[model samples]
Target chain A: MKELLEKIFENIYSNGLSEERYCDIKEFISEKLISEYNDYVMNREIVAKNKVNTLDIVLPNAKVGDYYSQLLKIEDEEIIEYWIEGLKKTGLEVVSEIVLDFQKEDNTMVQGSANLEVFDNDNIECQKQVIGTKNKGLVIKGNPIMSGDFDLTLKYKYKGWFDGCNILERKLRFAINPDPRSLWKDIPTDKNIKFYKDDFVSEYVTVLANDKGLQKDIVAASKRGRSHAHEGKARDDDFKLYHNDENGWYIIAVADGAGSAKYSRKGSEIACETSVEYCKQALQMPTELEETILELSKAEEGYSNRSISTLIYNIIGGAAHKAHRAILDVVKANEDQVRDYATTLLLAICKKFDFGWFVASFWVGDGAMCIYDKERQYIKLLGTPDGGEYAGQTRFLTMPEIFTPESIMSRLKYSIEEDFSALILMTDGVSDPFFETDANLNKVEKWNELWENINKEVDLTDDNSESKNQLLNWLDFWSAGNHDDRTIAILY
Target chain B: MRRLPVYLLIDTSGSMRGEPIESVKVGIESMISTLRQDPYALETVNISIITYDRDVKIIFPLTPLDELQLPDIVTPDSGPTHTGAALEKLCSQVEKEVKLSTPEQKGDWMPLLFIMTDGHPSDIMIYNQVIKKVKQHNFASIIACAAGMKAKVEPLKQLTNEVYSLDTMDSSSFKKFFKWVSDLIEVGNKSIGATDELLLPTPPEEMNRII
Candidate 1:
């Protein structure tokens, strides 16, 4: 530990800080270290305090008032209360009138009068409520504090669900949502935690669900289809969906892992996640300048949308390279299992434009990407799959050739158009069952019929969550004895 | 999405009755168990076993690894090694079972054939006929393993270029051969629908290459 700290200090000193700035450096170091230490300690405390129920609250896997009655048990905890207090400090808007409720084991209510308030500066704004034992709703006195810590105090006695007569006093503390935008910037180095989505989704679910600029609805899902031999093993296909509402951009990446690879599933997962992350970064690039460059370049060339398309193609291509590098990182870290992580990648990025949308897709394997226009009622195939010069062979992203910009550009396909309806990106597992070959992918009737079937089978008009679940279930639709792992990502 | 068909033909003549037979049994079992652990093999490989002593026996037909149960090999007390009968059975089975690709459906991948023996075959003419049939079509790949000293490579060479001569028919050699088989199946499973030829591993250091 000492050696590590000495190395860090040595590196900092090597940055050429003079003795005259010693006081300023000391203050900066103190503030930075204190903040980091606090964050580390606070995160640990929060995990330790609500280890059992934190995942439930953070993920909210269950819905209230559904066919199944959801059980929510808030325990007496210090961090939850302290974190509530921290949120008020961030000065974000918070809804007033926080409520608390107690319920019995068998969905029975316990009637009692309970008071909730935000005691800021000793000003107690008490919102009184009659808490029913069976259930109660507490509306916190403000909109969710976007970023920061906040504290809350709960004084309540509930009859034990198991014991029936013993009264239990509970207090809870919870930190408000942290800045979700950081998730795009901080790529996890740990392999096991790199693909974890609980925290990321909990923080950004609202932003992802927000369809402010999107002209239509988007539905996406993935599933492990039936295995020809093993009943329980997953098919080697994975996908990712990423959307940045503020940036008005969404990315869908799907990878079909090489069945020959022992850890192809891991490769597919890392590929999708890393590619989406890179695309998120690409979305931040100055596109206006790119457009200006394209416009000037277009004057020298023909009237084709080649320049703009090239820009979009390059962005998507660059993201694919980043994903390839991430996979290589995994391979290099564990050379013994180098071939285990081979997989094919397909990435598509779409951003809303004034007329329609600017869309680009890049692929280096056998999968299908289709763009369906609701207005024109036409379906377009983005590009052909890289089926190798053999009957059953295709290239994997792990191959070194795709790492170069030239090769990536050669593989990319793009479009800048109006009347954009929906984008369908899928691994071969799902695509194979639907369309046996790439030649059948662009059949307008088939695409339209598929959408019609989906509309009939799934409730897409009401809730996006329901549609997502339905799509996931739809992936399990078996046909032609083609049992493989299936993954599909849709943007509409 | 097509299944990769794998056929294993083992010689269970009187010569392989002792420790060699037991080793072969253990090896086959271990290979299946290992293949079951791989997600790719479990999902794609459909294996079949054909054992020949005096008479060929189809112990098990093409069955997926998930539902397949490795059967016990019972070699006859005294019988000539009829490898030709086993090859004939395999040829007939492939013709009967392997589906040809059609407009409506994709057929199974080219079959992977592994022929293992401890002695020379009694009926060489039939074996030559089966080899001719296999050569006419694109069988994924074929491997012939000559196990005991009595096993001749010249007879096996007529069947495949990928022929190996095990120095001794001991338990270790049998184990190494089966381990190679398991690894080869895994490679074959991964390459299914993605590559034309089976991507088999190099023979273990103990085994000798037979031209």
Candidate 2:
């Protein structure tokens, strides 16, 4: 088109009909051509702008307290390269420097504390960038300080066919997810707060007594759950571990207080203390029950020994009844309702006999008691969890119905093994996360996983000097939606 | 991971066409922001929105709190409030979405339900019929909010004992109500395993606990 216009001008100049007329013809054709050229370039710019708008620019979502980075891309290449290539095909060029800026609409970025940085330098820019060879596209990197929807506007500038620059704006949206762990705040329970109980009652207790044949080493750690700690609420779980050196018996009692109960912390404390103390006294040496247990241990595997069942009942079942009566005594003394002191009780008593080991448990609520033998790949659940029709519902020792002879006998579980790995008892806080269901408590693989996890945190080897703190740390493991006061006792 | 499923039943009838509906949208946005700040709710809470008008629709399916994108909630020029249909949808969603504990997997926490309306149910017969089904789901808590003067509390009582009233539908009033709702959610998340009825947090001044 330029050549044709040049040729016409030359023709007019050579003919020289009249100097003024020649000049007038040249001016008219030149003006018309310039307008047409401008119109064509404007049309091309519109098409290119439309294509730029259609570019798929997706930014990956970020997480709170996590460093995030994603390369700015249009198609596959860097934004600048993709834009320049797309414009070149449309007979246009980016003649001027390309600049990128994020136009903020609100305080979203301020709350997020994020920054856009050059990919290569990793230097934070104030949401603005000058695009060049060294800086192809943006690298949004930061440890997002908060979680929320962040709206961003990216303003791009580049010189077009005209001398002026063309500006394009793109809106981007992304959300920062809150870190589940960061949200949990561990506020120590206030001892002087309302309904306050003894802090040491539910805090933690560990024992290592090597007097028995198997060298019993036990660790019982109870920690306030994330939920309880979040609100400065007292721990509602308790445990008591005792080793009768003279009698050669190891007894463990764990209890979970009903969260809805007001004085459940005290209830759990009394339950654990009373149950273990009762068993400690009942399992004394030179007692009739000991001789019966010894004889039962020597009996055949299939022998249905009625005397042993009755004796085990009088020992373990009697402990559950004693715990219940203790809770009732507290209720009576304090002029409180039994429901206010609702708690679940799980008691395990084990003694090494000449024949093997006799392990018996009395469970009166939701929790778990198991005899786990990792080498033998064997797991025996002491009793079925007393889960109600709904998820959080479980019978409590404070409830009178659970003290019936039939109910107590039904809740009693005992086993005789030549050798075993560990006798473990836990509250629902631990069982709900580790075993999950009653059936899983019987699965050897699940027990193995639990054992491996425990070993990872608390070494169950020769020396358990650091096992207390390690076991307490292990109780802090995060399980989504399972935050409750955790209590676990392992006799290995 | 056990999710704490939360269902929001909103009324989008003709009466909520203008400022009321806009206030509701703002209220919901504020609620999401508040819940995001809570660590327990952020980890376990999953939200679903069910809107009822001349027609009932599930505007948003059950989505994790962090991944939720607030959808545009619009009301018709005029329409009937079919809360019964919304309840029916909720029942189906609960059955299809809320997991039950099994040996293989830990089930989701009992779901929570919140219903907001500015008028009585247009389909009363269906409402009565489905109320029993809704109760059968054994939600962790079912709270009903009667918004504005036109809302009848008696109808809400049939659905849940936890009925609240908002005197106005202004942005501030809705904001306060929703803020209280977030507190309720936080409390629910903290007390997930409690067998007793969920104890509600004290409501803001703009809202009143009717029951």
* Local lDDT at A214 for model 1: 24
Error of 1 at A377 (Å): 4.0
Q: Give lDDT tens digits, candidate 1, residues A166-266.
A: 22222333333322122112222233532222111100112343444324445666655444224324346777777776666778888988765666777
Scanning candidate 1 chain A in windows of ten residues, the lowest lDDT window is A197-206
lDDT of 2 by residue, B110-155 (tens): 8899999999999999999999999999899999999999999998
TM-score, first chain, each model: 0.54, 0.70
Tens digits of lDDT, candidate 2, A1-492? 667755776776675456687667778877998999888767765765666577776666567767766556443221232222221111212222222325432324444344553233335365224233323444455567766666665555433433363555556666677787877787777868656754322222333445442365677788877877777789888898887756678888899998878788989989989988888888776377667777777777788888878988888888888888988888898898888788998898887877788888888888888888888898888888887544676789988888788988899878888888888888988888887776777788988898999898887764464677788888888787788888888877
* Model 1 global lDDT (CA atoms, 0 to 1): 0.65
Candidate 1 stretches with Cα past 4 Å from truth are A1-214, A228-235, A289-302, A388-392, A404-406, B7-107, B116-118, B121-149, B153-211
Q: Worst 10-residue stretch by lDDT in candidate 2 chain A?
A: A84-93
Model 2 segments beyond 4 Å from truth? Answer: A1-61, A67-146, A154-173, A194-214, A388-390, A462-466, B192-195
